[model samples]
Target chain A: MSPWAWVLAAYGCAALLVGGYVWRLWCRYRHVSRVRLGEADG
Target chain B: MRPFAVGATAALLSVGLFLALWVSPPDSYQGEYVRILYVHVPAALAAYGAAAVACGASALYLWRRDLRWDFVGRAGAELAALFSGLTLLTGMLWGKPVWGVWWAWDARLVTTAVLFLLYVGCLLVRDLADDPERGRRLSAAVAVLAFLDVPVVHYSVVWFRTLHQGPSISLQGVKLAPEFLLPLAVNTLAYLALLGVLLAERARLASLEVER
Candidate 1:
């Protein structure tokens, strides 16, 4: 593999994984917040 | 995570990446394969730090029987797994070009892989138990035990003959050149910052799950 290929692969994967985890957290928090909001209204 | 922390993490990571890829010259020995070390080393550091947090938090949970500590413990274990996974992946990326193999049976590599799996098991133990309280207690113990592999992983190169290189930066002083060390130091702080942000956010999310 080229140097850029190796570097890009490593950095790209790191960025994507971290971004994905953060997105998952955001989704979960929103989900729970919605449930709490519904419960509050009910 | 708080806005300031989130911003700081992004800034540090951006600057660190630039320094790693652009500013730091290629290694005379390893050439461009050296760039992988920039990310690989920091990920390992962050992984070990997360495991330590998990161990400490787990012990706290055991002592105080506090759900808050459990939240941190769970977050720590999860981050440990994530970073360890990255460490292994990036290590392989570096290794294929340098070591000529995607995987090795070396002690450092094997122990690190074990550390990753053990923390993963720590996470699972909590959900698998019949009682929540029992699960917490059991997982707390598991987390503490899983942390034992961390030191073994760290010293594995010194303790056993391995493909992995010896410690570059340690109490004995850094072996990395100034150019390499600067970005590595920056990336280390960046990863630590990222670790803090993720840990707090994950713990907060865990709290919300219980709260709702």
Candidate 2:
């Protein structure tokens, strides 16, 4: 592969990995917040 | 995880990416591939910052014996591990085209690998310990000790003959061209902002777990 290919792949992988992590964190935050809210409502 | 902070980070990163890929000129020698530096360098710096935060929080935990400090230390360690993994991944990708090899036993690479593993071990120690308090104390100590590898990773290129290049931008002056420097600076700020968002969310999740 060309150098540009490598560069693009590297940046692409970094974006996916970091983005996935942030998404996971966001999901967990939402879940926990919902749980807490439910308990409050109860 | 405030909506405003997340939205701002996304917008900042979008602008940074646009500048890095489109506006910045290619390196005279390295050409377009040099764009990888925008991601690689920021990931490395963010990893180092996260590790430093972990080290400081670990020390605080040990000193005050507070669970809150332990929570903060854990969050920092997790982010450190994540960014370090990204650093190594991007480094290997960058290395393959430039150095003609994907992996090397050079001082900088080896030290960074060790640093990544050390934090992973810290996380394992926290997870596998039998008691919550015992786990926090043990992992706090591990976090502190693991941080000893950080300076080694940073100075490995200087202290030894290595395949890695020396620092490009430092206290002396900017080494990169103006076009490259601007995007690099913006991307670094964007990465730091992302780190802040991640750390805050992680800590909040951890606190919720403890309360439950």
Candidate 3:
């Protein structure tokens, strides 16, 4: 592969990992908060 | 996490990407592939910092028996896993082109991979335990022990022969050029900001688990 290809791959992987992590954190946080809210209401 | 922190992470990362890709000159030896150093080094160091946080927080939990400390410990461990995983992946991406192999059994590489697995096992020990209190305490202890590898990973290049190079930026001095160092510093700050925000968010989620 070309040097630029390697650089792009590295950066792209970093972006995906960081973005995917934030997404998962938001999902887990929202799910837990929703559960607590349901318990509080009920 | 707070809105201000969220904003800072985005802003810093955006600027970081701009500088790393554009402002930083290609290395004389490695050419464009050296760009990988920006992401790889920052994430690796951040992983080390995160593991240290895990170690410290877990020790506090053991001393005070506070779930709050456990929450932070969990956050630190999880982020340590994430950042270290990124470090390994980026390292491989850089390695394939440079080293002519995707993986190596070198000391630096092996030690870093071990650090990743140790934290991962530290996390698994928590969830796999039969009792909640036992799980918490066990994981905390695991985190403490897992941290012993961090220093070894940091010094692996210096301590043993390896395909990986020694530290470019160290207490002694920076070996990198000014142009390269500037983008690297910026990206490292961005990754650290992201780490702080994620740590707070994950810890809050752990707290909310208690509320429910």
Candidate 4:
């Protein structure tokens, strides 16, 4: 692969990982909020 | 926290970047690409600073069990990861033209990689624990220990065999040409300012979350 390709791949992977992390955090936060609301209502 | 501090940093960073990139002359040897030094070195410094903040905050949290310290420590860890990753990426880009290789398993690079992973583990461990307080204390201890590796990464050349070169700006008793040094200083300050702003915002949001 070309040098630029390598650089792009490295950056792409970093972006993907960070994006995945934010998504996971969002999901967990939503889940926790839902559980807390359920407990408050029940 | 103070508006003046943020304003001063922004002004300093803007002037610094201008001085480093535009005012500084290109290296006679490295040419245009050497300008990458302005970005690369500052990112590395910011990474170390962030990690140091994490270490200090961790220590405070451990000693006083303050939730404020814990939140700061968490912010530092995350910001440090961003800076460290950028440092490595820029370094690799700098290396390919100069070193003829994308990466070498040299001592400094290896130690930095380890440091990166260590903090990453710190973040994961904090997230995974069932007991929040226990997790905070344990992660704080790890953050402190992981930061100890920063010096090792910095001084690895003096301590071990490595293909990587030593300090670019600092020479025997002389510094690099003002042209080179100026932009580097600017970018460095810019990075520090950016890190501070991000950390303060993250900490504030975290505190608000806890209060709610």
Candidate 5:
């Protein structure tokens, strides 16, 4: 790959990694909130 | 996370990305590839900051014997590992074209890899322990030791002969032109904000786990 390709890949990977982490956090937050709400209802 | 914080991060990142890709002038020597510095350097700095926070939280946990501090420490460790992994991956990506090799055993690279591994171990140590309190204490200790690698990673280029370049921006002044530095600064701020959001979300998850 060219130098520009390498730079693009690097930034792409960084964005994907960070975006994935944020998605995971959001999912966990939703799950936990639901569980707590269920417990309170119970 | 608050909507305002999340919205602000997205906006800052969008602007930062535009600035990095389009507005920033190409390096005279490296040409367009110098754009990698905007992401790579900030990721490294954020990783170092995360490790320092982990170290401080671990110290607080040890001194106070509070589980809340342990939760904070674990959150910091997780984020540290994430950013450190980014730093290494981006560095290698940048290195491949410039150095003609994807991997190097230079002091800076090796020390950074060690820093990444140490935090990964910190997370595993918490999970592998038999008891929650025991795990917290062990992980706290691990977090403290793992942070010792942060300074080493930062200073490795200066302390030894290495293929990696020394710091470009420092407290003294930025070494890059304003066109380059502006985007880099904006991106750094965005990453810092993202780190805060992630840490808060992670801590909340930990709290939920404990409550359950």
Candidate 6:
């Protein structure tokens, strides 16, 4: 594989993994907020 | 609430990324691989900055028995750990090609790896402590001691290194051409500002959690 291809692939994979993690983190934050709000109302 | 702080951080990051990636000239030696400098070096510096904050906060907590300082210590410690992990990952990726191996037992690499592990251990300690107060104090003590390595990690190359370049743009004073310096400086500033904001947010969350 070309050097550019290797670099792109490595970065792309890392971005995907880190992006998924950030999404999960955001999801968890949302879930916590919703749960907290529900508790406040109940 | 702090619009100015948020705006400054965003702007810094934007400019930093732009300059580091596009403006900086390719390294005479490394070519495009030099681009890794924008991320790896900044992350490393940010990690050390966070760790230093953790150390200072840890000391304050120990001396005053203040929970607030402990909170700062914990929050910064978490961030430092995250950045340290990123630095190591990027370093390895950059290393494999340059050094011909992904892993090395050189002094700089070894010390940095140890530092990262120490922070990870700290995270576990905080989680394992049953009482918040007790946990914070204990973790603070640990953080203060562990941070001694911060200087060693920073100077590892100068002091003793198995493999790793010496200080580049930071101390060399305009060692990087405009293309690289602009983005690198911007990114470094952005990462630092981001670190501060994240620590503040984490501290706020911890305060609220405790109140609850």
Can you give the TM-score per candidate against the true fold? Answer: 0.90, 0.88, 0.89, 0.74, 0.88, 0.80
Per-residue lDDT of candidate 1, residues B89-204 (tens digit): 99888878877788865555676798899988987988899998898899889999989756766576555553455533221232567888899999999999999999999999
Best by lDDT: 1
RMSD (CA, Å), candidate 6 to true, equals 4.2
Ranking of all predicted structures according to lDDT, beginning with the best and ending with the worst: 1, 3, 2, 5, 4, 6
Clashing pairs for model 4 are B16-B186, B17-B186, B19-B183, B20-B182, B20-B183, B24-B179
Every prediction: chain A TM-score:
0.79, 0.85, 0.75, 0.73, 0.71, 0.77
- Candidate numbers sorted by DockQ from highest down: 3, 1, 5, 2, 6, 4
Stretches of candidate 3 off by over 4 Å are B152-175
- Candidate 3 vs 6: which has more lDDT: 3
Better of 5 and 6 by TM-score: 5
Comparison by DockQ, 4 against 6, better one: 6
Candidate 5, B10-99: lDDT as tens digits = 898898889988898887766787788888878888887888889999999999998888888999999999999998998888767766
Instruction: Name the candidate, 3 or 5, with the larger lDDT value.
Output: 3
Off by more than 4 A, model 2 = B152-175
Worst ten in a row by lDDT for model 6 chain B:
B165-174
Worst window of 10 by summed lDDT in candidate 3 chain B: B165-174
Fnat scores for every prediction: 0.68, 0.71, 0.95, 0.05, 0.66, 0.00
Pairs with steric clashes in candidate 3: none
- Candidate 4 structure quality by residue, lDDT tens digits, A1-42: 454454444435444544564465566556666766877899
TM-score of 5: 0.88
- CAPRI accuracy category, model 2: medium
Clashing pairs in 1: none
Which CAPRI quality tier does the interface of model 4 achieve? incorrect
Please state the error at residue A34 of candidate 6 in Å: 3.8
Q: Rate the local accuracy (lDDT) of all candidates.
A: 0.86, 0.83, 0.85, 0.71, 0.82, 0.71
- Please write out the lDDT profile of model 4 over residues B70-116, one tens digit for every residue: 98999899878877877777777766775667686555456567778
Steric overlap count per candidate:
0, 0, 0, 6, 0, 7
Model 6: clashing residue pairs?
Answer: B16-B186, B16-B187, B19-B183, B20-B183, B23-B179, B24-B179, B24-B180
Q: What is the TM-score of chain A in candidate 5?
A: 0.71
Model 2's TM-score against the true structure = 0.88
